[model samples]
Target: MNFQHKTVIITGAANGIGEAIAYGYAKEGARVVLADIDEEKGKYLEEQLRKGSYEAYFKKTD
Candidate 1:
């Protein structure tokens, strides 16, 4: 549960369970990489996380 300084990669993270998991990791101070085909949603989530001071990035999987 201690994810401090860890790096996590989550696929299909534009929405649903994957997004939840990504945010969970970010909340735990882990670096989160979100991969999905939905670029707009992925970018939006990434921006939201960044604004909240969480380390996160979005990558297109397709």
Candidate 2:
């Protein structure tokens, strides 16, 4: 399935299942939005995705 131009929002994406889902969507060419309380981890993952040429962003949420 082509995921180009698709968007996926994942909550609690700083670690575990959520984090995995974030990477999965990114690998599929989707723009992933990672929302979590762990800002450090979220930002780190966002940077990693960007470095890998994936579209991703992190948003801090409680």
Model 1 vs. true fold: TM: 0.95
Error of 1 at 13 (Å): 0.7
Q: For model 2, how does the per-residue alpha-carbon lDDT over 12-49 read when each residue is reduced to its tens digit?
A: 99999999999898999999999999999999999999
- Candidate number achieving the greatest lDDT relative to the actual structure: 2
Cα miss at 2, model 2 (Å)?
Answer: 2.0
lDDT of each: 0.94, 0.94
CA RMSD, predictions in order: 0.7, 0.7
Scanning candidate 1 in windows of ten residues, the lowest lDDT window is: 21-30
Write model 1 residue lDDT over 1-62, tens digit each, in one string: 88998999999998999999998999888999999999999999999999999999899998
Candidate 2 to truth, TM: 0.95
Cα shift from native, residue 1, model 2 (Å): 2.5
Pairs with backbone N, CA or C atoms under 3 Å apart (clashes), candidate 1: none
